[model samples]
Target: MKLISWNVNGLRAVLKKDFMTIFNELDADWFCLQETKMQAGQVELDLPGYHQYFNYAERKGYSGTAIFTKHEPLNVTYGMGVPEHDTEGRIITLEYPNFYLMTVYTPNSGGELKRLDYRQQWDKDFLAYTNQLAAKKPLVYCGDLNVAHQEIDLKNDKTNHHNAGFTDEERADFTKQLDSGFIDTFRNLYPDTVTYSWWSYRFHARANNAGWRIDYFVSSRDFKPYIQDAKILTDIMGSDHCPVELVTKDLI
Candidate 1:
């Protein structure tokens, strides 16, 4: 199975910038997106041979996520079942016979760490939700988790240490979650490799390759053996972020 995850930043904006063109090229079994920033009917998508599922934030033009899959899932869920956290429409889960596939746009802590407390709560809740699901089935979750997770996951780590996504609290939350038996697909595939998915629009970050690997394809530990490859599609251009991909040999 081939899965591709991208933080499109803005679906409508990327649509004008050849989003469909790249989408067609991927031809993945499952394609996921984060930071979609739109509600239903805001944009029209014609993805042939794919089932489209979208979760929109209550506050329009903000956080959202989507998934386009070739196969229909047994069940689909929109949130983590936490009322306080469900308003942003940041999560979407599709339950297949063998595993649960989820895409999440984790809350950003904001420029001055204003939302850090709430973000921390979210991190805790999200991990619990995933663990609950894992108790029933293997999981394949992907999206812009919004944290660098480690110093090696970003460029200029020293300078970005205090930044929103690189804050100590956020990083610790990620570490704790991973310790609970999930694998960062890319890192597990290439332990020391350095690559990034999200880049700042400032300081010519993309041009200089000053970026952060905030997006991820993470799975339950038991599911890792099936993953054949993990990739960061840095060359594709449209949004400030690029697509990350995972290829798994058939295990079903």
Candidate 2:
């Protein structure tokens, strides 16, 4: 099976762009999105043969996530069971017979590290949640995690070291997540090959290839063997983030 994840930034806005064009071109078995920024009934998507699950933030037009899958899940859950974290609609988990697929939009540690504390709590809780699910079944989780985990993950590493996504606290949490038995699929496949999924809208970043690899498709250790390959579709564009993908056989 083929799976793709992209942070459309805003689903409604991307609809006017070539979103559908790329969607059709990729033709993935599962397509996930982050930062959808819309409430229920705000938009209607006609995706034939795919089941769509969306999680909307209580604060409209804020953080959100959605997943479109050809394979129906045995169960679908909207959050991590924590009221504070669930309020943002940042996560969606789909449980299958043999695996659980999750898409998440991790909270950003805003400018000046204003939300770093909350983000830390989120990381801890989110990691615990995935680990709990992994204990039951192999798992594949992806989306805009909003952290440049390593110096090699961004172009201006030294300059942006302390930035929102590059702060030590944030990067450390990411490391802890991996240490807990999850594999960063793309990095694992292309160890030293540097590629990025997100770019700043300012200073002609994308054109100059000055960006950060903050988006990912991570899987539990048990699911590692099924991961055939991971890709960063940097060429396809609709939002600031390009799509990242994972290919595999029947997960069961």
Candidate 3:
């Protein structure tokens, strides 16, 4: 099965930018989206083949997530058991017979490290949530995780060391999570691929090939054997972020 994740930045804006066409081109079995930034009835999608599940932030036009799947899941869950985290609509899990598909829009630490503390807390909670789910079955955790993870994951590690996504603390948290039993699927498949997903809109970052590998499709260690391939659709347009995809040989 092919599972794709993309941080659309803003669903309404990207829709106007022809996200539907890109979605069609992907033709994935399951698609997860982050930073939807809209509420129910606020936007309409004409995707006929997919079953859409949305988790909107309580605050209008803020952080949010959604999942569009061609195959209906056995069950779907929203949030990470913390009311504080739930309010942001950052996580959504779809449970299939074989594995759990979790999409997360991890909180950004913000400029000047304003929300660093909160972001650390979010990392802790998110890891715990994934661990609990892994106890039941294998997992596919994919989305804009908001961390560069390693120096090679970003274009300019030296300059971005203190940045929100590249901070030592943030990278360490990501490392710890991976050490806990998840594999960064793309990096594992294309170990030498320096491709990235999200890029700054400023200074012609995308045009200059300046970007960060913040988005990911991380699989539980148990799912490693089934991972066929992992890809980043950098050529696709519509959002500042591109789509990250994972293809598994078998669902189980």
For this target, which candidate reaches the highest TM-score against the unseen true structure? 2
Estimate the TM-score of every prediction.
0.98, 0.99, 0.98
What is candidate 2's CA lDDT for residue 55? 98
Model 3 / residue 207 / CA error / Å: 0.7
| Clash pairs (backbone) in predicted model 2 | none
Tally clashes: model 3. 0
**What clash pairs does model 1 have?**
none
Q: Per-residue lDDT for 1-252 in model 1, tens only?
A: 789999998999999999988998888999999999998998888888999999999998998999999999999999999999999989999998888999999999997999999999999999999999998989989999999988889998998888899999999999988999899999988989999998999999999999999989999998877889999999999999999999998734
Residue-by-residue lDDT tens digits, candidate 3, 2-71: 9999999999999989888888988989899999999989987888989999999999999999999988
Winner by lDDT: 2
Q: 2 or 3: which has the higher lDDT?
A: 2
Q: Write the per-residue lDDT of candidate 2 for residues 1-252, one digit (tens) a residue.
A: 899999999999999998988898899988999999999999999999999999999998998999999999999999999998999989999999989999999999999889999999999999899999999989999999999999999999998978899999999999999999999999988999999999999999999999999999999999998989999999987899999999998764
TM-score, ranked from best to worst: 2, 1, 3
Candidates 2 and 3 compared by TM-score, better number: 2
Better of 1 and 2 by lDDT: 2
Flag regions of model 1 displaced more than 4 Å: none
- Backbone clash pairs in model 2 (N, Cα, C under 3 Å; residues 3+ apart or in different chains), count: 0
